[model samples]
Target chain A: MTLNDTDVRAVLHRATDHLSSPDGLVEGVRRGGRRRVARRRLLAGGLAVVTAASVAGVLQFSGTGDERIDVASPLFDEPTRGDLARDPAFLREVTDAWRGATENAELWLRGEPHVVWAGNTPKGKAAYVAQRSLDNPVVVQPEGERLIGYAGFVVPTANGLRVLTFEQFHDSGNLDGNSQAVLLGPDRDTLLVLDFGHPVEYSPSMSYAPDGRIVRQRLPVTFRDGAASLPVPPQLTKVTIAVGRAPMSVDSRIHVVNENEILFPDGKERPEPRRFDYVLPGADRAWGAAVAPTAWPPGAVAALAPFLDSIGTHVVDPEAPDLTVFGATPDGRRLLVSTIQYDDDPGHAVAMLGRGESEYPVVATQPVDWAEPLPVRLRLPDEQGTLVAAPEAKLEYRTGASGTWLDAGRGAALLPAGATDVRVTPASGVARTVRL
Target chain B: MRDVRGTEFDDFVRTRSVSLLRVAYLLTGDRHAAEDLLQEVLEQVYVRWRRVRTTPEAYARRALVNRAANRWRRRARRPESALGDLDPATPDATDDVALREAVVGALRAVPPRQRAAVVLRYLEDLSVAETAAALDCSEGAVKSHTARGLAKLREALAGSGLVVTIPNGSGSSR
Candidate 1:
């Protein structure tokens, strides 16, 4: 039995005998042609931007910085050319003109509008660049459709700006205009990014694009969560601002006590508070003793001990130290930790459970002003309990034999055995003891 | 400026899509992938309609070959998730269905370029010089690839007790 050309043809026909052109082949071709035309238009727009920039001579920078002030950007390898000392006015004029043009470039690529806004730090420069479609907030490019993706930076000299951060929706894959900060770097050409609020770094973690360009402009820069929206000075074409910090968290176990009560005991109801020690990763273990205040529950102290110890080492630096603290639930499930350091401007000194990491919030409240006091609520898995408090009041729980006042996390614990009442005091309002 | 209207392209598609789809299915073993490949090449033809219209079938075949090569390269770079579905040890020569399956599976086993060489030579009935021109390779390279491809197909299907015989003096014409 030999397989000849005729046999091969028979098998080939058998495999594809039922195949035919799709109903929309012509329409598909027309759509593809439109996309090709759009790509050509984008290429032309990019060339136009490059050409117009060269003619303006606005990008002139020494690509050199002060010997003491080291400057870096994730997208570019070398410093952009600049003559900062020679002509401040010329630099200023060119920076302003370029920024104005960039703000108005409004180049629509593949049906999406792209905009860039150059900013400045007192000592460096930065920019906030984004591509968005108001009609379609989702950035996921449809199959066979090319969506605009960028790999570039806002380069600024150290004498100009130092921090570069961008708002990126890491897990969502779409660049939604959320307060979530995706990429963060300080004086480094490439940024190490944390994806999806995880403590561990993401793969391909650095943003380093070779052909990154420097733009000078003052567009709308919105800084929330204590991030500074700085001005773009004349000396800098690019700018950098501090990246957003991820929230901190810890794991806790609790037993439900009827409708409004849950007890946090070593295992079950305890006459004493549960004790668990933890050393914050990336911080000095010894300093944990110095940092854990009596106002915090022993578990909160144990959770924050390492970070407090490491503060002495990071104190000299003006910026907040990036930290990750790990803890485990009573059942031993790994609890994710994200931290905002003491020096973080606009960030609080308190350590608290981040949203969506665990079932309960474990917070160690410092007397910092920025700690937004979350409302207190206690409930079992099924039923809601009746406990009332003033709107301005923060929740307080009883701790130790002396019943010392402790800041409470926004969660309920397991109800204690034979406990008739669970007392919750507000910061200023009267104490509310719910009868179980 | 090549302004070929939708009806002209549609007419051409309605007439030749089945033949083009068959060639694509032989090139890519999967039916859906073959349809996709044909649609993609047709879209390319639409963009360069004026130049492509002169030798539409040949241009479409060339585009299909290039696209398959690129897709194969990308797939090769991806990590292997499982042991391949084609088992080398289980080729049964007695079963006709198994032989057909072995033959079809063996086509995918050869390297993409060599497979294209084999398909153009035997399936499309193209001569050596024409296959060489289609593959953008020398005639000697085409002959070498065809011989190696046939030998590989024969070896792959040998476990099933299937024998592949090359036609004598075939694919020799200019």
Candidate 2:
């Protein structure tokens, strides 16, 4: 028999003529598209876990089999003026390095290099000065005496010069008196200290002092580059960060506060705080990048190494979570840290000090900035009959055994004697149970 | 002016869906499976509709052929159902109906890859290279599959009073 293309084409066409396009083809495609996306996401999540485990395993095994490895402190030993003057070799090295760096045209084209900080020796003479070269933008410490102590990174921004630094003035007997970290911003003529007169500890309450007068005191959450830098929200002004244990199973959440006002614990009306909660991957080997800041001073990484070493190993675990919140005072001067576990125990705060006392009291409770939001905020009455008002904010009040929630918009639906078993939920933010 | 991407896609589906469904039906050999294949292809096209709109038909047809090929690969382990059972309608007591049924039965017996090559090469009238691209293979494989598929059809339709001839060299068979 002779077989040709026409015979085959015509016959096949006639055979399949009864079949038609599916009625819900577009809808089916939409559903299939969703499933495909879910599959891709699951695959990507799996790959991230595998990569984290491989990295953790490599870090764990690459170390020497010793049960404990002491990571040497990166801070200078016995930072004093006498040590600076006596070290001719180090002094010569510092001078030559600065001279060579300045000679390069690439290091001074953008701006002139200036001495950001100068250390004082025992005899009240300048021991050494740390100058930042803007052309290349690096911290350079030039020679002088060795005994002096100075640690910080001076950053020049569009606003002005900001310094991340810690210094102890040796003039008086008050060791803690002069030991302060400051972040100086462009807003005011005076310096701003983030944790001034405060012990170097995990996630200290932030204080902003302009012209030596305290302007603001509040908690801030800071996240750094673990996989990638967690960028500062464009609208946020002050950021303070501390690492804490996971409040729940998921690693993070962003809580948007209501735009309206709410009564603070002090009975003064203030807008509720909006913040992001990031729970580091728990004890499980599954992981993401350990969070950290993208930009740090030349020596800041070295200074921070001891803090991380004191807490845990290179690998991060989800169940046994290890995290650190890196923040500065409003002025961006002092370094602040907060963590769940440090030095193999909870409630331990350590400031990296060259000499003198370093231990400080653990905060009685996790700072409000780092804690999860409560269900509600119901302030008791003041001396006058004015109930604390949250301007233009709606509140949901739940009363009695009926398990029903009733709207009490700006105190409109409440009884004069107050309702029993009332729970108040803000128009936004977490809710709280209120006693009438 | 509003965006025209959604309207353009709807127009293309309205105009070309029947032709696409026919190709899908021939490739899948089942009505339900043909609809599934067509929908799957449309979904993929919908995702990149902006980029594929200019050559939407070609893009969709390629996807349909490839997806059908994949389904066949997965279903390769299953035994082939009897061709007569595919459509139980007794031929409408006509000579042309019997011959058409005989051709369909013969085409069903061909393996999926060979069937795709045959439908693409003979029915849809794609070149050896186009068929190779649609099947994601070399031109040589397309040529070999087409030849073997036609030979199978010639044998299956020998006694059914239908003559099937595959032209040699570089000329159109018609």
Model 1 chain B, TM?
0.77
Taking the candidates in order, what DockQ does each have? 0.19, 0.18
Best by DockQ: 1
Cα-based lDDT for every prediction:
0.41, 0.40
Tell me the tens digit of each residue's lDDT in model 2 across B1-174: 122345677777767787888788767765567777887788677656768989998788789888987877776678866665555555454655565567667767788778888888776778887788788888888888888887787678765665544453343422
Error of 1 at A222 (Å): 17
* Collision count for each candidate, in order: 41, 48
What is chain B's TM-score across the candidates, in the order shown?
Answer: 0.77, 0.77
Compose the digit string of candidate 1's lDDT tens values, residues A208-237: 112111111212223422123232212111
How would you encode candidate 2's per-residue C-alpha lDDT over A1-436 as one tens digit per residue? 3655566666766665655556765545644543333223223222111000000111111232112211111122222232234555544444444334334211211122223222321212122223321111111111110111222223333533233222211111122222122222232111112221122222322232221111222233322110011221221222232212222111321111110011121223333222222221220111113223355333444444433322111112122223232222122122223233321122222221111123322211221111222212222222111121222244444446565676655422212223454444455765655554
